[model samples]
Target: MGQSAIGTKMITQIGILVHDIEAVSEAYANFFGVDKPAWNWTDTPDKAQTEFLGEPSQARAKLAFIDMDSLQLELIEPDFHPSTWRNYLEEHGEGPHHIAFVIEGMKEKIAIMESKGMKLQQKGEYTGGRYAYFDSIPQLKVLVELLENDK
Candidate 1:
């Protein structure tokens, strides 16, 4: 078999959306035999209303950032209004939500995905990094995200 041209990039993070934050976080902590993540709460700003696709409301999410070697595992629980994470929990229950790949040429890659009929779910910047969400593998029920750090 010939090698493919697509080179493997570093997986910076994996995000999991869970209904119960404590339970899920504990499970991962025990499984990985690592320290529990430091918790933080994030609120969507009212001024940033244009970012939300559905309603004009501020959503709250509890994030636990766990460091595992060079990669970070983020476990998120949507506490306020329903978001993509909440919707995923409602539809598929608690599980892996998205795989984040850190790479260069984000805009070019997004354009390529769009040209290939992949739908763009969301795109924005957070904490000096840019992220773009794409539709899941139809029948597989998963999301793929391309993350680029400006730092």
Candidate 2:
């Protein structure tokens, strides 16, 4: 096999979309014998600078993170806004949304994925980092998210 286009094999997070974040997060915590985590909303569009399908979007979602040994399991409940999360939930119902990897060079990595025919879907900034999602379902059976944290 050739070098990975994203240049990383470590999947840092698995994002799952649900209709109710609190209910689902509690269920997961109980199932895993861990404490239910507090859920928070993604930053607003003004702070996140969110874009969906190359256009500015005001999408947001409730997010909860459950920490495991090597990766975190994320539960997402999207708002009515137009975003990858909302679209996936409406079209496919609740289920796994994307697998994320920690990375550097956000722009270059995005370009690499695009070269491989994976169209960029959504991107946004967070408090200490930024994220980009690629439409990788046709190739990987799931969306791919790249997280680049500031040093």
Candidate 3:
């Protein structure tokens, strides 16, 4: 398929990682004049241990998923410990966390991006989907992600 076609078919989700769950959630809700969506916390200890960063590491986070007509907005609030979000916040404060593009050929796309010097930051499977973080962002820039919904 053409690159444009591949990109068009991708499920694009915008994620915001912040320190304050209520504040950020409220801001988005009020900004859009919509109620804050409920949080969906995935607690798969076995799955997380096997796929995620292991043992939760005291990094508690709340995720709110908002579904628009075409795209989904995911608001992530980092509680308790420091997470990737917290790290981003420490460096850049509140802003865009990552722009996720879901594609069918995740492995192939990741390989291509890596070959182009995009280093892999993190990789894991969660809720039947394979996700990876790439450290290609220039200083003070937001990170990018590639998500493959295996389900």
User: How far is 150's C-alpha from truth in model 2 (Å)?
Assistant: 0.6
User: Which 10 residues in a row give candidate 3 its minimum summed lDDT?
Assistant: 48-57
TM-score of candidate 2 on Cα atoms, chains taken together: 0.98
Clashing pairs in 2: none
The order of the candidates by lDDT, greatest first, is 2, 1, 3
Most lDDT-accurate candidate: 2
Global lDDT scores for all candidate models: 0.69, 0.95, 0.67
- Residue 23 shift from truth in candidate 3, angstroms: 2.3
Compared to the true structure, candidate 3 yields what TM-score? Answer: 0.76
Quick one: best TM-score, which candidate? Answer: 2
Tens-digit per-residue lDDT, 39-142, candidate 1? 77763454224134434445557889888888888898976564566667788887888877776777887777677566666565555566676775673366
Candidate number with the higher TM-score (2 or 3): 2
TM-score of each: 0.76, 0.98, 0.76
Candidate 2 lDDT for residue 96? 95
Candidate 1 versus the native: TM-score? Answer: 0.76
Q: Model 3 residue 12 lDDT?
A: 78
